[model samples]
Target: MKNVLILGANGQIARIVAKRLLSEQADVQLTLYLRKSHRVDDLVAINSARVRTVDADIHDQEALDKAVQGQDIVFISNVDHDPDNELTQGVITAMIKNDVKRVIASNVLGIYGEVPGEYGRWNTEMLTQAGLNRARRSDELLEKSGLDYTTLRLPWLNDRDEVKYSITHKGESYVGVSGSRQSMADVVVKMIADPTYLNRESIGLADPDTQGLTRPVY
Candidate 1:
């Protein structure tokens, strides 16, 4: 069985991805790591044999290392809010220690100033310069970490159940200002199922139809 460790497992997108994996990928086992293990009691109850929970802060290096051990992939659904990017760095350290090479991380759009026009200005205003810089630093650290990684730069997210999204590469301007959380979860599930997909790439995701909106779709 392929073991997948999901950090920030209680997050909305991560929860969706976990449920999808449980239903669609019978060959996969999950290690759900979150600060509050009780938040995932339902998942563990669903399949205790295939699902495990780790309740510890990501900064707990020993716990993080233990969780990463023997996992085929690590999915980070949380953003590092630390100004020093300590959270991302900690995950990288743990993955390296455990020799886990595959990772998929979530980030926000406008990190590279890739959004354009009025929407871009609005996004910048929303995130503020400091927030954008922190995200950029996280992506930069991932690029230099030498792990097989895919950084997903997501736009404003909504609860829409539909899974429709378009992708743009690193240097390309971001398309659309918002997308569904389901779309983001779908992309993560795809990458988990196929390790070679989008390896070592940082890409943007959004619903193409949401493009050019001065405000977020939420």
Candidate 2:
């Protein structure tokens, strides 16, 4: 059985991931870690034997450690609002203590400021430059933490259903400015089920041939 722990389980992406995992893979043992357990009552309603919910703050090292223990892989869908990447730090410490490897995290594009052309400048100026430095710091934390991690740097996320998307590596100049939330969830599920992405890598996800807007239009 593959033991998986999903931090920030109450978030939109994590919520989707939880349902998809349970529905798709019978052998996946998922522990959804959320700050507020009551927020996920709908999920618990599913009542699958392979599902577990944890209510604790990720910053609480002891509770985080307890959650990380006996998990083979960890996925982070949220982080604290601190620019110092305190949440990421807590996760790294807990994972190290529990000897857990393999992490998939949702990050944003332009963390490296590698988006080329006028769109790159626009992204850095009007879009990602606001308060996203904290996210970038978290990305840096994961990169140097010596864990087999994959950071899915996302573009403007839309609520539309699944669409054809493309994945780009770090320093490749992020393309396809927007991506569907379902597409991101699909990639996360793929990463969880397959072992082909064991090495540390940062991926940029987007649709094709379009410059994303400042925010997703519902």
Query: In TM-score terms, which candidate is top?
Result: 1
Deviating ranges (above 4 Å) for candidate 1: none
Tens digits of per-residue lDDT for model 2, 1-218: 99999999998888898889888987899899987788988877775578888898878888899999999889998744566677888889999888998888878777788666766666677645654687788887889999888888887778888666888887787777777788888888888899456358888878775645444344
Of the candidates shown, which would achieve the greatest lDDT relative to the real structure?
1
**What is the lDDT for 4 in model 2?**
91
Residue-level lDDT of model 1, residues 1-218, one tens digit each, is 99999999999999999999999999999999998799999988888899999999988988999999999999999987788998899999998988999999999999998999999998899999899999999999999999999999999999997999999999999999899999999999999999999999999999999988999897
What C-alpha lDDT do the candidate models reach, one value each?
Answer: 0.94, 0.80
Question: What are the runs in model 2 whose C-alpha is more than 4 Å off?
Answer: 126-130, 209-218
Worst 10 residues of 2 by lDDT: 209-218
